[model samples]
Target: MASKESDAVRRHWATNRKAAEENRQDGDQELADHRWAELTTEPADVDYLAVPGRRAQWIVPHGAAADRALLCLHGGGFVGGSQYSHRKLFAHLARAVGVRALVFDYPLAPDHPHPAQVDDAVDTYRWLLDQGIAPEHILFTGDSAGGGLTITTQLRARSVGLPLPAGAMPFSPWVDFEATGASYDENRDRDAFFHRDLVRGLAWIFLGPDGSPRDPFVNPLYGDLTGLGPIYIQVGGDEVLLDDAQQLAAGAEKAGVEVELDVFPEMQHTFQMAAGRAPEADDAIRRMGRFARRVLELETR
Candidate 1:
């Protein structure tokens, strides 16, 4: 049975789904983004600074290490979401891991398509390198579409001869743009915020008419997964994207990469968003923190 708090989260997200559906019907993306920002609770101990040359922010938790960093990407189905909407969630993760985090806004769909987001992510990563952060000390993470970005960015870095990060942590990643996973059908009624129609629409907007859904950069499940560092993936068992996480883990393992995937029963997508308030979320973040510590060689707090 799900905990009471977890049930509360489900109810909360159910309400959010209603609002999101209405917003989708009304085509009010701006309002939807505003509501997302409003729903997140910023941590009191984390400080943020806007990056001068990039659409990114540095989320520095108190006493965090200067040498280690997590480059975080926000999830909004590749159409919505921004730095403001995801700052708090990344801040919580950074705080738990005892490291600074860089959360950035990448180009969205309809206005900007496939390679645009890839270009922006690569640019921001280069900017991080230029700032004197070593590739081995860095980590990457994201939720939903942003989770997919985490994997693609590493591939992009490898393609460009740039050093890859020490590890990656993706939460409920939406990697299969074709929506071919069995979970899409099995979890159809269980998942609150995602469905075939909605993801299909976002896929079209993100991939554009000319792009292929299986393009490794667009759907990382089809990408070469060898040689990337340790990866930790977390997914809600009830999410429609559950199979994306499973397939990614299996693919990475087959490629001889170290990987771990955890699925929380009855949890919703990105349940880590409730960190500090929900026990399940807190436990998930702690696990991620331990993974960061091990991979980045950070001293135990």
Candidate 2:
């Protein structure tokens, strides 16, 4: 159960989220880009790499042996989001798991369109394998659209006989881009932000005319899931993406994948961002850190 302090923080974050979203409504892309840029840091612990295909960059955290590398994807409706936006979250994962992470920049839709993001994800994984990173030592992580990318990449990798990663973690993933789920409508008011209309708008822009919004690459739950590795996901009870999390879990179970899921009630999307003050956020981060550690340990052994 969450504590009273955590409850308060949740409320505060919810209130602040509304304000922030409204304030930056006109500058969504700019805000996301700025967040992506924030990933650059000092101490030289996490090295950055610029790879081919969609301005891809990797974040390598120090302390852990360089052998283990995490491929992280950032979320922004497949049009926005980058490594910089997820600095704190990924850095915490690196420090806690004692491993380096590579935050890849996948191509966004509308401009780059479908197959581009998935292709970039596959290329990045291949790059990791080429660098001699063992399949069992690599893990995939992402949030929102990036979360979708993580799963789609896994599917594509498996189809091509690429070595699967040790495990995968996706937080509040948008699994069904087709918007066929009921929660997409029901959770609109429950979640502080993330309305159905907005998601659909973004979807139309990203998927383009040639793309089938329901295609498994765009909507992971619609694909075949057999023979995938262990997986875990985190989501808030109030987020519009809630159905995506639940349905994905069910699909993973049907596919015979070892899957673990954590759901926090009354919480909003990616609440872990408020970790400094929000107890819920702090607890979620701790949970994610612990999950990463366990996955890496089990895979390494």
Candidate 3:
């Protein structure tokens, strides 16, 4: 029942899982440092900002003004990952779309739960506003679990009467914490880096005893997304998160939000990270860059 392309991606992930596990045990701080080092070769016009309660980094395109900004959220479930791991990718994204990226160091779960990550995301937007960036000129982007957080934060922003962002992009988002998506089973054998069981295990850890895996913050597809900004979700047809992406796309459309769902036939989750080594990866990133460029141009007009 698995396509050849999907099967190949699964093989790649199976081979890479050991490395992912090692990185997990090594801790986010260590992984972030290593990822940052790898990104030194593709440096951005970097700047730092010290928020009263948190810190953030700005990756701007060279020779470009900071007229537009994308508040980036990096994913490592809810307890792992940091801005460092995503520095090069964000820098490239900033340059590719000719916009600045404001990557934040949001607090993780167990230590900070449910609303913490959500609140931190809202706080990052506020930080952007305080620095003179208009809310209409800002967008939000994230991957995997961070993708869910990005949407959750947007909801929280609305509840608190905060200004809405211009648009959003969630790459292979882990949107359905309940893990009931058809792709969870359909693509189980096809996906490489992530499987339903692996996600559930980590989700349980992050949610703790008091946390409900079904909570909208943890599972955004169940939430009300009405009146939200334009959203583009990219997912691999072979990914276990394929269902999460699909369900969210449907939910967003039902809520009347402008939504675009891109299902790449043979790709895997986070393939863009492997772009330098994979042609499919390059194509995916280019597609995303083009999408973001369109959004940016529309916002400017």
In candidate 1, how many Å is residue 194 off?
1.2
TM-score, candidate 1, is 0.94
Tell me the lDDT of model 1 at 140: 94
Q: Give a tens-digit lDDT track for model 2, residues 205-236.
A: 88888888778888877788887888889998
Q: Which window of 10 residues has the lowest lDDT sum in candidate 1?
A: 32-41
Candidate 1 lDDT by residue in tens digits, 79-146: 88888878888898899889999998899888998888877898888888889999999999999999
Error of 1 at 18 (Å): 3.5
- TM-score per candidate: 0.94, 0.84, 0.86
Candidate 3 per-residue lDDT, tens place, 1-301, comes to: 3333334445545755767677645455775556533522354464444335566777767764577788899877887777777767677666667777888778877788766788778877877888898877788888888888779888888888888888888988887766777787788777776777778777877777788877776677667888888898888777898888888889999999999998887777765555444556556667767777677674355
Kindly report which residue pairs in candidate 3 clash with one another: none
1 against 2, candidate with superior TM-score: 1
Clashes of each: 0, 3, 0
Candidates in order have lDDT scores of 0.86, 0.75, 0.74
